[model samples]
Target: MPLSEYEQRVLEQMERQLSSDDPKLVNTFQGRASHGLRRWVLVSLGALVGLTVLVLGAATSNPLVGVLGFVVMFVSVVFAFSPPRRGGPTGVVGADGEVRRSSPPARPPRSSGLLQRMEERWDRRRDERGR
Candidate 1:
């Protein structure tokens, strides 16, 4: 069933509160591609090219060329699957070139699970009907 206007408004209020409390969490849900997407694409292309080279080398009976192609494919695969590196601190810099560090935001406590939410809603409706 579709939510009523009051429920929609309540949901919007909750979303606004969540965004204000943790902007990073909101950003994560925005569905943007990761920074390493381009790098991954390039690595995949390199691997494909390496595979083609390997096939050609084997057909021509060139052992050295086949080995080189294997090395390229292996390196590309490793680079593509490796975890991204965390470069440096992302802090604001003052005019004097000194980095200004800010404390991380405090995380909110975990929300209730589905069963807990259903129980709470049931109790609320029961209390309302009793009144």
Candidate 2:
């Protein structure tokens, strides 16, 4: 059944509140692209090169070359999976001449798990229906 006008208004209000409270949630629902296709292509090419080097090194029985190839593969994998660094100052020197590294931004604390939140909502709805 279609929602009544009042129900629609309530849903809109809830959505507005949610968006204002958690911009991340809004972005997630909008399906924003996290990374570009170019990055993936470069990573794939690096992995391919690493694999070829590894095979060549093994075929020639050169331990040094094999080790270098393995290192390349590891580095490529790390680069691929790592999150892009945000633009910010790496560190600042205090008045005491001590270097302090910048800390990451604090995340909002989650009060309850998804399941708990769902159960609470369900219970609330049941109570409303009973009234």
- What lDDT does the true structure give each of the candidates? 0.73, 0.70
* Candidate 1 clashes between residue pairs 3 or more apart in a chain or in different chains: none
Candidate 1 residue runs with Cα over 4 Å from true position: 1-34, 91-131
User: Number of the top candidate by TM-score?
Assistant: 2
**TM agreement with the true structure for every prediction:** 0.45, 0.45
Worst lDDT window (10 residues) for model 2?
Answer: 86-95
Please give, for residues 11-126, the per-residue lDDT of candidate 1 as tens digits. Answer: 77777666555554454554346667877888989899889889989999999889888988999999888875544443333334444454676687765788987898899999
Model 2 residue 105 distance off true place after TM-score fit, in angstroms: 9.7
What is the per-residue lDDT of model 2 for residues 1-131, given as tens digits with 9 covering 90 to 100? 99999998887777656654554445444443545466677788888888888989999999888888888888889989997543333343333434346465589777579998899899999999999
- Give the range of the ten consecutive residues with the poorest summed lDDT in model 1: 88-97
As a whole number from 0 to 100, the lDDT of residue 104 in candidate 2 is: 57
